[model samples]
Target: MRLLFLAVLRPHTGNAVTAQRVRAHLEAAGHVCVLKDAFDFESPSEIANLILAENFEAALALHLYRGGRLLQGHRIPFGVIFGGTDVNEDANQRDKNTVMGRVLEEARFAVAFTESMKEMAHAQWPHAKGKIYVQSQGIATTPNAAFNWNTFLQRSEINQSADNLHIFLLICGLRQVKDPLYLVDAFSEWHQEEPNVYLVIVGPEVDPVFTREVKAKVKRSPGVRLIGEMPQEDLHAVVKNCFVVVNSSVSEGMSAAILEAMDLEVPVLARNIPGNAAVVKHEVTGLLFSNPQVLVLSAKRQNDRIAYSCLGA
Candidate 1:
């Protein structure tokens, strides 16, 4: 099979990871894949022309609207992979909903990262119910546990302490849907009570306005550390050392970061959104919280338990 995979690429992000995974899977199965970054094209017509030029047997798109539109316009047998914002947040808008609905209608198959996401697509577009498929996003190669922690801490400015310090890592590109500042006020209050607890926000500032807001909030809250995006391998190594991984996104398809933490055997603390709930089994794989207080308390308890268990071993 000759496949064409399309997505808006970033330096280090989940969408990039998804596109890479699909390409890998197809290639490993003895199929040829032509991967293209949709954002690189100046216009959608360029993307359409590229797809037509490749004579692709099948097309796979990451976002429902942009990627879907390009491929669908070419009358290709394409698949739609819903991104976090598309089904959860973007679908709420009238124009986006219509675009997504049309994409879903024309798609040969619609892939979602989680079961909940599949359900959302079904409910959103009942006409395309039978086409939805759920596949767990693959994690890239796991990090070897041989990295120099001392050097990493020095480079990242991460304080290495096991006594009373609790670090919660939230990794996501700064965007409105991520709601990076949701826990800022709560983190400040918690920091006052437990000076040792720290929240680290790590990811590239994809949106300048949102990134500026996040930076402004970080300035006011000393407990929050805003480390912009790090390399994928480096981020995985950091996840291994952290006490707990955290996510507070307003919407998600399936949190690749949370899944990466689970794959690395690091516990997770995530928001109670459907995507997060699908990954974190609540007290099993990780903890989920609807309120800020619950998130803080559950995160602390889970972090302590994980730490004690590690020490005992």
Candidate 2:
């Protein structure tokens, strides 16, 4: 079977990663998959032309509004995998919500990364409840041995020793929904007290206006630096070296960053949003913070624990 896979294929974005993974799985199962970026085409007819040209048997879209909107009016059967923003952000919009509802109504199947996400979709579009399936993405990490920590720190203009630095790596695309600046003030204040501590924000620049604001904020902020984007392979190594992984997004479906941190055995400090709370068990797998102050306090407490443990040994 030949399938057309549609997603927002922005570089270093989660939707692109998920689309590639799905394509790999379909191909492994002996199906041919044609992957395309939903943004490349303007209308349903444009998508129809591609589908007809490729002779695709089925279609798979990553986001309801961003990707699924294009899959509409096509004769071929299609499934939609919920993007984080679709449920967390766009569902609140009157026009977008209506379009999403229609998309789900016509979709042969749907996927949610977590049970809570599935429940949210069901509440919004109860008619498609049975067709909505929950499937957590499979994650695996392998850090490259050749990655040089000192070189990365130098290139990122971070002045600290690897042994003493308590680096918190916050990974997210530079967009408003991510709220990458949420903990900037708290982390900066904490840094004044603890000179060895640093908070690094790394990801692609998705919003130029927001990116400019973040860069300006980082310029004035101490111990907080925006590294923009790093290659995925190098990022895994950077994640491994960090003292803690952070997620300060205002909303999320299921953050690949949090999961990747857990998989890499790096401690995580995530915003206490429902999506994050679902994945992180407080004081167990990782810590969840309701606000910047809470996050700062939690990090301090965790650091104290580590200090005590080292002294005891």
Candidate 3:
């Protein structure tokens, strides 16, 4: 079978990763999978045309509203995998919700990473509830033996000494929905109190305007650094070295970063949104913060505990 896999293919984002991973599995099973960016095509007709042109037997999309929307009236069958923005953000919008409803109505199957997301979709469009399946993204992290911690620190351009720094790595593309700036002021204040702490925002610049604002803000803010994207192997190495991994997104379907951190045995400090709370068991698998102040205090206490245990050992 030949399948058309559509997703928001921004270089380093989770959506792209998930689509590619799914495509690889299908291809490995002897299916011919063609991957395309949903954003590249303007309308459902455009997507339909491409599907016909490519002679795809089926279609799979990463986001309901972003990708599934284009599959609305197509003759070819398509499946939608829930995207964080689609479930948590776009579902609330009147226009997007209507389009998403139509998309879900026609979709042969839909996937939700968490039960909470499936429930949310069920509530929004009860008719399609049975078709939605819960499947967690299979996670695999590259362990780069050659990655240098000192080199990574130098590239990140931080003034703090790596030995003493309690680094919190927040991996996400620079965009408003990510809420990357949510903890900037609070983290800075905490850093002033505990000089060894730093919050590093690392990922590709997906939103140019937001990226510029973040860069400018970081210049004036202490205890925060905006590092450009790194390769996945190097990123995994960086994640292993961090004191904790952080996710400050206002909404998420599921965060690959948080899962990666947990897989690497690094504690997570995540926003207490439904998408985040679903995966991170507060005080169990990781910590969840409702606000910046809570995050700062929790992170500091966790850091101190780690330090104390190390000294005792």
Candidate 4:
């Protein structure tokens, strides 16, 4: 069947990764799945026209309000996936909540990244509770075997040698919700005591204003560097080489970067949030820090407690 897959395709963001991964799976199973960035359309009618023009059999979307909103009243039997903001952020707003409720009502089904997420959506739209399914995001990574770690560091314009470098890579877009600067000051202080350690925040410049703030802060904060967005394959290679992968986001539906790190056997240091907690089980899977202070302290303690090593690193 020809399927329409709608999602916010922000370059190098989790939404784009998830949408592409799901689309690839559908295509592998012999279905023709076409991905469309939901932001391109202004209204449901625009997508409705596309649905008819392309003759898509069924539709699927990543965010209820962003993607599912376009599928409403289209009679295309689309499924809605609750992206983080729609649950953690948008559910608190009256106007967005009402529209999302309507979207859930018409959606053939809905997907939640974690059981907690499913419960959140269930609480918001009780009538659609039965239709919401809990499915953890699948992960795939292609780390280049011959990837040059030193060259990559130089490209980021950092002048450090690659020996004994305990790189803590925090992956997030430069946005308020992502909180990329959460560990900057703490990590910088820690780096002063331990020169071998460094914190690198890398992702797309999602918001211009927030990007400027992140750049300004990173410049003054010693041992913290902000790298531009990278291709998925290169980023995965960097993750494999890094000592730990960090998630300092204020909210998340589910983090593809975290799951990919676990897959690569890299240790994770994530913020203490329900979304991060669902996967990161403290020291067992990775370390979880409650605040900025604990961010550095936890890393210091967990340095010797790493259970897994990156393959071929």
Candidate 5:
């Protein structure tokens, strides 16, 4: 079957990564999938024309508002996959929420990355409850064999030995929802006490204006390095070597980075939002922090555990 899959295809972002993976899976199963960025087209008619032009048999959308809404009014059947903002940020806005409700009504099925995410969506649009299925995000990490750790540290201007360095890698697109600067002040203070520790943020400049703001603040903030986006494999390589992976997003449907870190057997430090809480089992899968101070305390605890382990060895 020929399928049209719509998603926000921003470089290095989760939705783009997921959309590509889904398309790959469908194609591997002998289905033809056309992956398109929802941002490229402005209206439903454009997608309708594309569907007719390409003879797409069925459709799939990443976000209810961005992709699903555009697929509305089209004759072809489509399924909706909830993006992070769909149930978290978008649902709170009246205009987008109204559009999402109609999209859910028209959708044949819907997918949520976690049971909690499904519940959230169900709470907002109870009419689509039965169709919403929970499927955790899948991750595949390939750490670059030749990725130079010392080189990365040097570039970040982190003056510390590779063996003694404790780098917390926070991966997120520079956007308001990510709240990338949430721990900037706390981390900077922590760095004064532990000079070997650094907080490194790596991702695409998603929101240009906000990215500039982040840059300005990070400039004044010591022990925090903001690197530009890296290729998927390179990013995975960084995650593989980092002391801990961090997520400070204001909201999330499901974070692929957290899953990837867990898969790599790396420690995770995430904001104690409902989305993170659903996946992180407190002291089990990862540590959850309710605020910046708690997050700093958690990091210190983890570091102490590492120190004890080294002494034991």
Candidate 6:
């Protein structure tokens, strides 16, 4: 079987990881797999021509609305994988909902990263109930050896000797749906009360306007560190060294960052939303907070009680 996998690749992000995983899986199983970064194309017609040329047995699209439309227009037998924003946020919009609805209708099968996402899919598109499938996104293979803590801290500008400093690492591309600025306001208050506690925002700034806003907020908040984006290896190393990993997205499918933190045995402090709640089992792997106050309070409590070395927090 010749399979064509399509997605917007961010070099080393979740969508890229998913695309690579699918391609590797299919190829390892004796199928021909080709990966196409849809975002690189100038037009949909070009994408259609490329897919037609591939003579693919089947196609797998990462985002429902974007990738589905391209494959569907080409009359391809394709499957749609829901991204965090697709079900949690985009489906709420009138125009995006219509586009996503059509994609769901045309897909041979639709995949959700978590069981909660599977339920959301059914609720959103009841007519396509039979086609929805729940698939856990597998974590990347762990590094061969333990990460160097001192090297990672030095590169990320983290001070290891600051016993009072409670570092919360938030990793996500700069986008409106990610609510990247949520931590800015929260960090301001936390910074005033607990001078040593700092919130670090990491990830690429994909959206210009949103990136500008995030930069502006970062300038105002001394405690909030917006480190733009780091390489995948560096990002993973930083996640392993942070006091706790944070996710405050307004929407998510199943955050790859949250899962990576869990896999690395790092404690996650995420927003109390469906996508995040599904991964970070509250009080077990990490704590989920709906608002800034709750997050700050929880972080303080966790910091006081739990030793970072105990569970690699």
The TM-score obtained by model 4 is: 0.94
**What CA root-mean-square deviation does each model show from the true structure?**
2.8, 2.6, 2.6, 2.5, 2.5, 2.9
Q: Write the per-residue lDDT of candidate 6 for residues 1-313, one digit (tens) a residue.
A: 8888878787746678778877788789998988888777665588778867877777888888667666766666889888767787778888988878887888899888899998987888888899988988887735424567666556656566776667778898888878888878888788777767788888887888889988988888867787867667767877776778888888878888988887887777888899888887677677878888888876677665543433434
lDDT of 5: 0.88
TM-score of each: 0.90, 0.95, 0.94, 0.94, 0.95, 0.88
* Residue 136 displacement (Å), model 4: 1.2
Using lDDT, give the best candidate's number.
5
For model 2, the superposed segments whose C-alpha errors exceed 4 Å read 161-163, 304-313
Q: What are the clashing pairs of model 2?
A: none
lDDT of each: 0.79, 0.87, 0.86, 0.87, 0.88, 0.78
Q: Candidate 5, after superposition: displacement of residue 114 in Å?
A: 0.5
> How do these models rank on TM-score, best leading?
5, 2, 4, 3, 1, 6
How do the residues 1-313 of candidate 2 rate in per-residue lDDT, one tens digit apiece?
9999989999888888888888999999999998999999888999988988889899999999999999999899999999988998899999999999999999999999999999899988888979999999887787887999988888777885634788889999999989999999999999889878899999999999999999999999998988868778889999999888889989888888988887887788889987998888777777778989987886677674632322232
Off by over 4 Å in 5: 306-313
Cα displacement (Å) at residue 130, model 5: 1.1
Cα lDDT for residue 97, candidate 5: 95
Off by over 4 Å in 4: 157-163, 306-313
Off by over 4 Å in 3: 159-163, 306-313
Query: What's the best-to-worst order under lDDT?
Result: 5, 2, 4, 3, 1, 6
Model 6 lowest lDDT segment of ten: 304-313
lDDT of 1 by residue, 16-90 (tens): 878887788889999998888877766657867776787777788889876776665666678878887788888
Provide the lDDT at 81 for model 4.
84
The whole-model C-alpha lDDT of candidate 2 against the native structure comes to: 0.87
Off by over 4 Å in 1: 41-44, 144-146, 154-162, 300-303, 306-313
Error of 5 at 263 (Å): 1.2
